[model samples]
Target: MSSIKEKLSKPFASLVAKRIEKWARNPEKTQQKVFRNLINSATDTSFGKDHNFKKISTYEEFKSNVPIRDYEDLRPYVERVVNGEDNVLWKGKPLYFAKTSGTTSGAKYIPITKESMPTHVKAARNAILMYIHETGNTQFVDGKMIFLQGSPILEENNGIKLGRLSGIVAHYVPKYLQKNRMPSFETNCIEDWETKVEAIIDETLREDMTIISGIPSWVQMYFEKLIERTDKKVGEIFKNFSLFIFGGVNYEPYRAKFENLIGRKVDSIELYPASEGFFAFQDKQDEKGMLLQLKSGIFYEFVEADKFYDENPERITIKDVKLEVNYVMIISSTAGLWAYNIGDTVQFTSLKPYRVIVSGRIKHFISAFGEHVIGKEVEQAFNEATENTSITVNEFTVAPQINPNNGLPYHEWFIEFENLPENEAKFIKDLDNSLQQQNSYYYDLIAGKVLQPLKLTKIKKDGFQNYMKSIGKLGGQNKIPRLSNDRKIADKLYELQLTK
Candidate 1:
């Protein structure tokens, strides 16, 4: 059965590849069609009437009438929908609301209309399918695949279900593939991440797992539990495991740790998905970036990252994007998000294929003293620092330490160790040196004495986890902020340090 499924996946994935290629070849036309379809689908709704969606035929016209908005801007319509108002945002009330963390707001309830489910869920499946098509590694479909997901049980918000995006996606896993899914339904619904992982360990211990997917940090925790229970390397426990899929966070810092934990090298794929929509995925092994999902029920725009905080930043469409320019991503998707700033920054790596590398979040940066440092640069520094040393960071976050009262400002890193480097000072030095090499602005700040060198703050074992648990956020789809310009998270970590 596995061999037969493998053979069938090749042809099906080939068709998806062809469609994606065709869409990439003429993005402008494809985007226009997507826009038209969206307009037609929502024309009778209240938002459509207010925006005069019926008369909008061209991109310029659409832009002229519809203003750019973020989550706050759309909250009114979402609130109306939450009150059981139909045809408020889209044609009808959303099927589900994907609950995600908001930067300033407590939590954002992003509408997940039936129309938008394909973009969020099917695009993920297509990512794997395309990977298989490119690599001819159909054997990945031969055995059980473990997806560490949020609990599927949802909370009712008015008439709509509200839950994590992963939980919503899990509900749509094809029936044909259910047999190959790991961690029984009861284990998956455990609510607490630690307890769920423990149940998963017992349930999947002897299963023929071939693929595993989750956020890198949580997956590492799961791997540690597996190793503790079995006293065997992950490679030994799941000999057939071949592919590892990860998203929702940067994977570079965790790469060394994962390679060590698994006890062997294996294929890994990166995806860029948000509650709003699935944006991009790694399409080739040799590629340095992910292919943009241009035709996946979303129209994308980019604003120069440096100017994104400005009152009226320039919005550049797909046609105007330049290679290597860091831009904050804006999307108008079937999820009823119009020119919404998703708070993510990306740089185009290939214009021909429309591939982009996610640089960092708009809110996740250290820019004190005019030295703008994004997550990608920080991850690169960590990767470079650990390359020649035995240091393997299990978890880490950085924040700007402005006005330490006696000295210049510097980046303060809070890190938990899986393996400590022999020369800890050398590790810190290497990290600082690598950052200077990767980001010229940061280097200039150091050279000009505008900022002091970076400082490392060691976090004890499970410090991050304990903090999250204390705040009642120690569960699926939640992550510690990696970088911050403000002292909110830094102060909390310091408080946690006092307790430790």
Candidate 2:
């Protein structure tokens, strides 16, 4: 660690420690304060005035005034802001628009305002600092940290600079740490995942890296590339590498793979960051959930996930939330998003400290024949089915195949394997039985002859990676939707594999 960084770490960690202490004392109280701040900050803006923000003194009043909305519902204000209008959403024009892909909708440009910086950027910093403070592991900060990020080259939409959220965050990397950051600016702007990763391998192969962070899949790809280039394990390549920060996908399925690749057990932290806001982070080593952000320039609400699809869904505040209930998340943030449905569903694992486990997206699921299956359930099924097998699924996606031969519809899984089981048929059958065990609705459908047994389609090696690369949707902040009700993702994979 540099002398300057060593001097700075203690104080920074102390500050985060204090903040975490305050957050733990009374999350509900802190959230109400956050709600008030958000309302006051935007009261004079167009959206605020339209929603009568100034009159909303309490959470109940705020909920009463602002109805639930999605990106499309706020398009008019966003369009005005894009045309360089001031105070349409936030108090002034956004610093940038964080572009991200939507499941059913196309690309969305979320406004990133000055007020959102603390929540989006600072909260991320706090997650790291708090972890270091709690664990007393400051050695990782003493050395380099390789954050595999997206292209830094942003596109200009009217007067608004637009690009991936990771790129925007990269622009804000603390100057002190920039000296140890990996992948040169040129490599980061290369625009192709495969080529950029190769560039990254060349630049970071010999760096004294101790901390690494990014989407798990992309980082895995980088590790594979590094091993291919150096012909050495990751532990040997960067002997000091000790911390990994991951988000954008569940890390459970990839945990064993990552540990084996590193050839060592490294500390890991999970983050729940969206273009909308940074919501949670793994605060304790043994905790099963990430601590929810209560005072991060965002007011949050939760609607029961099953009820969210209804015409009139029930929106509940943090104070009224119960543990173990799957709820779709809603947020009113500093970026001018009011009662916006972020599409994520989370279950509160710990209410006293306000920790949650993300279940799935409101739109990302398979329910083609009344057999609703979510990302969490799908992940659990995979974990269960492959528990004692040699099968290691690297990446997978499921889509419904309706009437393949003028017969009943069934879910078709497209999977890429790192290790294929000796008996593929038994593996498939086990997977089918597991899903049925997890979701009784799926089981009933099969028994009632409404849907056939699940089908497995083994994808060629690196097929998911190739598909992601082909669509320009590879790397940071991008994830393949695992369970789509329709065949959009599945059809693309089929076409890509057919051509190959």
Candidate 3:
């Protein structure tokens, strides 16, 4: 760790930590200020003007003025912005278009305005700052930090640059940290994720890598590779690597596997970031949920998850939220996303400072027999089933087997195990029991004989990785859905000969 940079990080992190406290203590006031600012900034823009933003003074008025919109609903304005139109969504043309692959929508281009870009960067920076403030760990700042992300290389659409959000974030790394960052620019530009990861290992295998940040699944691939090449745990390869920062998907499913790969426990910080806006981050080491970011130029609105598909589901702001209720998170941000549904659901773990855990995605659930099993429920079941066992899961996904050969239909789990458990039947029984307990609807269905218990299909080691590679989504922000409503991914996984 560098002497000068390490010294500077603590004070700066402390300042950001204090600032977070102020906004967190006054969440309602902070959100209101953000709401007003966003509305005012976009008032002159095409979308704002269309929605009567100038006249929308309160949440009720704003709600009535602009209805909730997904990417398709907001595509018209985004299209105008893409074609080099000024004042289309935000005050001016977006600084960049964060392009993401969508399931039904195809490619989605989320705007990143000049005013909103800093918020993304600051939120990420503050996540670390918050970690440092809470743990007094500044030793990580001086060593090399690497974020396994998409190619930093970008393309131009009209006058605006377009690329993956992580790639875009790559371009904005602090100047001071430039020398401390790893995976040379040339290496990062490698389009193939596997190749990029190899190059990254070649460059960083012996460095004092202190802060390793990436999606847990992808990072797992990297760690697995390091172990293969060096025959040592990742912690041994990079002795100073202390902080593990992750986002995109919940880390619980991979927690045991990661700890096994690392050979020791390491502190981790979870972030709730998306192309639309940087929403929240783990603010305290001991906290269960990330501190919801209210002062980041984004006003949050949440609709009850059960009522999300209703014709007129109620959208409540931060002040009306309650603990442990799943909500489809909505936002009106400075980036010109008005009442936008980001598709992820959240549950508040703390109401005092408004902390939230990303519960699951709205569309990523299985309701084959009215069980309505969500990602969180399945994960909880998996964790509970494997709690004290030597078995560690590498990756897993769930789908309904509606047409089993000769029996009642059942939920099928495709799992890649790091270490297979003894007494396979017992493991399946425990998993089924845990899942039934976690979800009452699922329990009812099981007891009623409407559906059989969940069946676990063990896949070959690295099967998930192979499946991702086959689908051209090996890494770089792409995550396998924990559970799905349909058999699209399930069919593919089955076809790949990944099953044991």
Measured by lDDT, the strongest candidate is 3
Full ranking by lDDT: 3, 1, 2
Per-residue lDDT tens digits for candidate 3, residues 85-196, read 9998888788999999988978999999999999999999899988888888898888899999999889997889999999999999999889999888999999998888
Better of 1 and 2 by lDDT: 1
Cand. 3 TM to true fold: 0.98
Q: Model 1 segments beyond 4 Å from truth?
A: 498-500
Model 1 per-residue lDDT tens digits across residues 339-456: 8888889999999889999888888888877878898888888888888667887888899888797889899888898898899889989999999998899999999998888998
List the candidates ranked by TM-score, beginning with the highest. Answer: 3, 1, 2
Q: Estimate each model's TM-score.
A: 0.96, 0.94, 0.98
- Where in model 2 is the C-alpha error above 4 Å? 1-4, 7-11, 102-106, 155-159, 498-500
Candidate 1 residue pairs in clash (backbone atoms < 3 Å): none
Q: Tell me, by TM-score, which candidate is best.
A: 3
Q: lDDT values of the candidates?
A: 0.87, 0.85, 0.90
| Candidate 3 RMSD computed on C-alpha atoms after optimal superposition onto the true structure | 1.2
